[model samples]
Target: MSYLRFDKTLMINLEESLPREILRTNKSGAYHCTTIVDCNTRKYHGLLVIPVPELDDENHVLLSSLDETVIQHGAEFNLGLHKYQGDNYSPKGHKYIREFDCEKIPITTYRVGGVILTKEKIFVHYENRILIKYTLVDAHSATTLRFRPLLAFRSVRQYTHENPHANREYQEVENGIKTCMYPGYPELFMQLNKKNEFHFEPYWYKGIEYTKEQERGYDSNEDLYVPGYFEVNIKKGESIIFSAGISEASTNDMFEKFEEQAARRTPRDSFFNCLKNSAHQFHNKQGGKHYLLAGYPWFKCRARDMFVSLPGLTLAVDEVEEFESVMETAQEAIENYINNRPLNCKIYEIEDPDVLLWAIWAIQQYANATSAEQCKEKYGDLLKDIIEFIHKGKHDNLFLHDNGLLYSNGENKAITWMNATINDRPVTPRTGYIVEVNSLWYNALRFVAGMMHTGDKAESIFADSLDELAKTTAQSFIDVFLNEHGYLLDYVNGQPSDWAVRPNMIFTVAFEYSPLKPEQKKRILDITTRELLTPKGLRSLSPKSIGYNPNYVGPQILRDCAYHQGTAWPWLMGFYMEAYLRIYKTSGVSFIERQLIGFEEEMRKHCISSIPELFDGNPPFKGRGAVSFAMNVALILHVLKQLNKYY
Candidate 1:
């Protein structure tokens, strides 16, 4: 049995299946996302969603869905599911699904009276195409299949309604037809491997509702355009491949293309492999530059996310070349930022105060994965430049004080990653001598000092100066951040120090070089484990802290308010586990391994084989936010790597 298989009992239940979404992405920023039972609960769900540079930077949903009908003996069973208004589901096709499994690719089995059919779907890598192969497993009599394509030519951020400006005309192609609903949009080419008949019947399917959107306090209802259906006959053992893409493909080679793509997939047959497969989906290649997307359903190439996730997503999986390729692009962005020139790459927020610090840490991880020598040979200059850039007071917000600690001005803007905004103002504004930022700063200084202390005389002299600066920074870090309560303060501005217990202090113990004493580190970890640790991860703020909201739900403002207050973020678990193992060594391995049980169960939960952005801080700890998050997945992989070292 497959590790991610769903039986009929779960597949037929709307409540159980609708929340379980499946996502498939091509390396070129195209994806196919929907529920396990083929129902689109969100406007972001689609059969072919791709990025169109001419239209905008956002992804557009071209083919919303494909409704399939099985016909025999003049009886038709429409096997497509869509939620309408008033909690109504048209056709209710999920009742016919016997099983759904996605070990290698998404495969669905359907049983209707005397016929058994199997549907397998795959997204072609590095291309804007989706291929679905339908096989007739067992049939007593001849059967015919009908396919109707529902089109939504709009950005994922917006919905489309019935408009008179839509072009209902289509051009006939080989065993298919191509149509463009708008002028700037690319024409959608939907073709079948075998000969089929297309009937020109353009109609509008109105009032299709997305429950996920409504629950999030957004507009939910939209209309989809259907441009007729295609009918094709099938034999008992015959298989037909359907292709949907931005460009036309050869009808004769569709079967071969599908097989080639399927062969490249890594089977999600186990917990580790599931994460490994999901990690590869975040790779986006555009304009000869490689980038790591922050998440699926809605996110882009954010600089902080890329640096934080690069090592675990690549080196942990033993993909050394990919790590170098992505870093090459990031290196360019860092250089451009320092030189005061426009970044030619696709990365966003390169000027964030902590991004450069995270970049140095990413290179440090590369050193840990391979060797310090190899890392220095490749990225030594970049590391030196980053340290020099910050030391010379070149950054906009990050200022080096006389105390040797870096301070950031987050009073106006959300400078750090805890950044949640409302009405263009920060909600949890952490300013001046933040815990993680200074911890990262100290680690970077010490690391560069070690890397540059080798043979060159000038480099050795620079390393000595860095050592002196690190010592001063360490003394000030203990003085300003560590309070009398045995736990570190979150941040220290002009006002009374914010002594809230947060996951930010975990970095002090997790880094290889730390400013805190061993006992001081132990006291912080004890406080963290007691107050902020959850089965999912570490909470942003302790429950005992005032203004703590444990759940992330309701409208936009409410969700934003609770986003970082007390929500548990899985990415923090990586640092927490590292601190535990570093302090307790082999004695803590068993305890840390058992802590991962909750995350293992999540592999079969929301967004199968992937990790979500966060979970509620309260009981049940249900997943919320983006379905598949890059940093969450990557850090978990890093933890797994650390565990293997113990064995």
Candidate 2:
């Protein structure tokens, strides 16, 4: 039995299966997602979702789902499940599911009377295609399968109503037919591995309700266009494959290509292997450079996410080439900005000073993982170039203060990672001399200085002024940020320090180059462990803080207000583990290892085989936010490897 297998007892029960969703992504930024029971409960769920760069760099759901029916001896059974208006389920196919498993791919077994059929699904790694193969496991006589293609042909974020503009005609392709619903979208090719007859009976399936979207207070109901159905006959032990994609060429060697791609996949024998596989999903080629998608389903590439997640997502996994490529991409973006050229890369709408610092820190991590000399040989000049940009202040409002802290002022924008704003107002509003920014600043300066210090007088000349600045920053950081309260302040403006007990202080100790002393690191961890640390991750704010929101719920405005207030972000767990280990040494290894086990257990709960973006701060710390969050998975793998280094 596969690790993520579910029997008919659970599959037949919609309550248990509806909430559990499955995801399959390709290297080309296409994905297949839906609930475990082959039903789409969310608008983000789709059978063929691909990126359309010309359509504003967002994923478009060309084909929502493909419903199948089994016909035998003049009897027909629909194996498709859809929720219509009035909370009714049509063609409740999930009731016939004998078994379901998601070890590597999603496989569902169905037994209807004397006929038993097994269906398996896989998405092509480097192409925009989905292949579903059905085999006649057992049968008394000849049986037939009918496939009805449901096309949404709209942005995943939007819904489609019954429109006259949709083309009702389809052109014959190699093994099947291709049809284009919208003029701007690509033509969707619905082909088969074997030649079959195409019956064009176009109709609209209206009032298809998306419960998740409704719960989020958005337009939940949509109308889907079913162009036609494909019918084919099969005997016992015979299998048939169905393909769908933007191009007819994607169907070439469908089965053989899927097998070859599946063979190259990393084994999901353990939690770590699953995470390693998930790390690969975030990488996509865009703008002529390798980029990492922040998360699955929703998030696109962002500068902060790229830099913060680079070390864990690449270097920790021994993906040296990927690490270098990402760094080069970041450097190219900075150069584009320096030369006043079109950015054309992943640049956050609000430029983050800490993101620039994290780039330096990520390179330092790569140098630690590999050899410093090797890092210098490849990224030496690139690091200098980035440092030069930071010093030159290419980013808006970012400047090095006389006190050695990086300062920026913005009333309505979030400058740091606590960068969630609602209705034109910054939530956290960490505008000036944020705690984490300064911490990263000191670390970056010292780290790059250490890298440059490896050479002679001429080569090491850059380290002289940087070293002095880092020294000044460390002293000023302790004076301005540290206090008798036993924890570092979250941020400091012209007035008194905002001494909210936040997890941002942990980075000051967790980093390889720390500004705080040994005792200070211990004190910071003490407060962090007592207040912010949860079983799943680190809380954004302590419960003792004034504006702590334990539960992240309600409308967009409510959720945005609580985004960084007290949301327990799984990515922060990495820094917490690092800080705990740095202070307690080997004695803390088991503690972190045990905590990692909790995260592994979480993979079984939400977004099976992946980590979530955030959880609630209070008890029953339920996983909320994005389902397949990339940074959370990357950080967990990176920090676990870091802990293992001690042993």
Candidate 3:
């Protein structure tokens, strides 16, 4: 899920490299320290430790992924705002500055406090002023884990860049640099002495390097990483300020201006808490979740992704009644898509098909949380239309399948984002029956059938049909999807479908409205945990999978191949947690509880910021790809809500 970086964009923080943080294991065996850093701030947002850690001064050292391990030091931004987008430019403002220092910061719990709850505070040991916040939020409350992780600053300095090409588009007939200011810590800052420094620095993943002497030197066209250095003195009993604004040349000005702007703008926690509370209310009363973050799909202007996250974000925060309203929104979106094709006649965005399944999966959650009468009465027409649309295949109904799986390609093929591609190449390039889709279809049918039964239509027939469909699904599609290997195929209908273990089955296992039996659910959990589970979350595909991409790099084909190949997606952690809960409720909670107790701490540790976008599966592993999705945030809120169960 996305966290607020100093840049102000809700993006992923894929910069955790601390072995302990990235390893997902705490110093002691019992707790897993899920520590996240705001890659930009280089400050600890919060942390999760299993069995809890006995906080010592050492525990307070903010760990960084990019900090050269040899140097063992950390860095922070001096944005006039105290935040940074990348090390290169001002956040959305796109303006740039060369310096600032870590000084006073503001913070408080968001609820009773102003829109931004955190107020400035000072610490003893480090003597660095930083912001601190304590919150129940939505996710972790279900479990009895108290988060007391602290964040502080060690040191940070600034270097300026002379980029004449700052705003100029590379492909837009651009020549000569479009100059703009950028604050960065390059080798030039690094002291020749290695002892008092962090060995590592932020290399522009795809950046041009420069030398202080060569601001307009002969090496003008060449991009180089000018070495830089600085120091952070986190002496014992010290703290650093976590400023509300960024680290621009004028920290005080940015703070004073943004503090007022922040005051005028929508409150940070309000936006977050609104999404959470609204979702929680819906889940509690409606019994289902609005899977989409913002709005829903199809006609009437309600989009697909928007509606699904409604419950997860809205309800999880506090809006209980909106659950039904969101479900209503989903109804309208789905019905319009089926009957009218407003979203897409084929529902294909580029060359992928997962969005459709994701939308359907959302509806399943919506139905589960709402009353049969409410769902049927409000969304009866919408449900029928969606079902009819799924049934009505392309090419004038000539491409219908008995089992109900969508095929973007001619055959019963699979091509979702996970298996999608572009430029005649697959981002995922999946070709065959996949696992998540069919499972979603089966779940959707049962939900619609049950809803139909509740309607004034012929109930008995729909119920029996649903039962038959369930039986058929249990016997055929399941076996077809899952193989003798015990691992589910990334896709079927191929000579040997890729037997990649992923978080695909979490939905079927997690959702109360799934089509799996007790034994099958147990198996799904076992496979998922063994292959996909990581301290951060579930990886897109197991490293053991042949197709897994170990590194994040290259062109569209290369990147797309790596997209779902072996990326560890933290967002899936919520689903994995939910599925684990479901399995425990049925069987005893032994294995699941064991996993959860350990995972509770693991979830929090080493996550740069609440969550990093993705991480390398290898040790001393570092996070990569830095854009967080709302669902990941929603998942955290949901998990937190579940934590309240213990209380």
Candidate 4:
């Protein structure tokens, strides 16, 4: 049995299979995603989705899906699945699925009587292309294959209706055809490795429903245009390759290209390998610059997510070169922010108050990975500049107080990572001295001070100032955030401290430098474990807290409200585990290992071999938000790295 294989019993059941999605990315901004049965349950699901920078920032769906039909003895058996209105699924191709596995690439086998066909899919790295190779595994008689491509040349966020404006024409290319639905969109070039007959039957497949969208209270219906069907003959033990891309390709080399791409895939054979593979998928290289995408399907390169996830995604996987590549781009963005120039890179929210702090923490991880000397030689000036930037009050919202704690005026904005907003106003307003922000601030100051003190500048006045300021900040942190309940307050504004039991306090215990004593750290950790910990991860808020919404459901407003109220985020587990191992040493290893089993079981659930953005806090803890999240995958890899240290 393969690690990620599903037999007919699970593959044929819509209720069981439809929710389990699979995602493949090209390392660029292009991707191919859908359910295990090839049924698109979300509008974001597609066979070929790529970013159209010429049009806009959002990803555009080019080839929505490809439906295959197997012909034997003049009887056509459609091996395609589509959900329509009135709880109807036409063609019902999932019933023919004998097995589905993704250990290497996503492979689906269908048995239609005596004919058994296998389809394998791969997204070509660094290109906007998807290749699907169909093999006739077994056949007793002559067989034929037909492929119908459903096109939806629209933004992933919106759906297209049956309209008269669509171009109902296509140009014949080598072994296939190319078409463009809209004027501004790029032409979708679709081809096969062998000769095929093109049947021009342009029509609209209307009223296709995405049940996931409906459940989330969004527009769920769309009309996809089918240009035509390609008919080709096949023999037993022979394979044919189909390619869909934004640009044209050589028909003869499609097979070789598919094999080359497959050869590069890190098989989803184990939990760690699954995480490593998912981590690499988040790497988006564009315009000769490297970046880490925040999450898949709908997310872009976010500054906080990029820095926070950078070390684990690269360093924990032993990809030190990749770590430096992303940092090179991120450093440029930070420089642009400091110089008050427009950021030429694609990183979003570089101006966030805590992003620089997180960037310093990433460098700390690098220091641990290699050596303090190497980190100082490479990122010393960058660290000094960040601390100076904060101390000099150069940031717009962040201010340096006389008592050494950092304050941000997040009155109407969502400054920290609890950043859900309603009508542009913060839903969970953590305005004043945020616990995590100050915790990270103190850690950065202490780490930089230690580095500066030990480096060539042993008698540096700047190092002395940092050490002095760090001590002051440590005292101020305890005075402002630590409450009588022995747990840290989420944030303090002087009006009335926001005493929500959030995961934000975990940073104080997780970071290398801490303001609290060992007993105090233990107290905070115990409270966090008691109130916020869950099988999925640490919940954003405690259930004992008021306005705790445990389930992430309903419409946009409702979901946003629950985004940080009580939603469990897996990335926090990275910090929670770090704190655990640091405090308990070898004794904590077994407990942490047992806790990781829940995440390991997740390898076969939801999105296979990938971690999601968030999960419901309540029982069942259904994975929600983005199907594949960079932070969750990276942090889990970080935990595994920490675990390996004990062994």
Per-residue lDDT tens digits for candidate 2, residues 15-123, read 8888788888887678998888878988889999998877877899999999998998899999999998888999899988999877777789999988899999888
Error of 1 at 177 (Å): 0.6
Q: Which candidate has the top score in lDDT?
A: 1
Stretches of candidate 4 off by over 4 Å are 456-459
TM-score of each: 0.99, 0.97, 0.54, 0.99
Q: Name model 2 segments beyond 4 Å from true.
A: 250-252
Candidates' C-alpha lDDT: 0.94, 0.84, 0.40, 0.93
Ranking by lDDT: 1, 4, 2, 3
Model 1: runs farther than 4 Å from truth? none
- How well is each residue in 373-417 modelled by candidate 1, as lDDT tens digits? 899999999999999999999999999999999999988789888
Instruction: Sort all candidates by TM-score, best to worst.
Output: 1, 4, 2, 3
Question: Model 2 residue 38 lDDT?
Answer: 77
- For all predictions, the C-alpha RMSD in Å is 0.7, 1.6, 16.0, 0.9
Which digits, one per residue and each the tens of the lDDT, describe model 4 over residues 305-376? 999999999999999999999999999889889879888989998888999999999999999999999999
Lowest summed lDDT across 10 adjacent residues in model 1 is found at 493-502
lDDT tens per residue, model 3, 144-248 = 111111111111111223344322121101111111112221100111111122222323312222221122122311221212223333222222222211111
Question: How many steric clashes between backbone atoms does each model show?
Answer: 0, 0, 142, 0
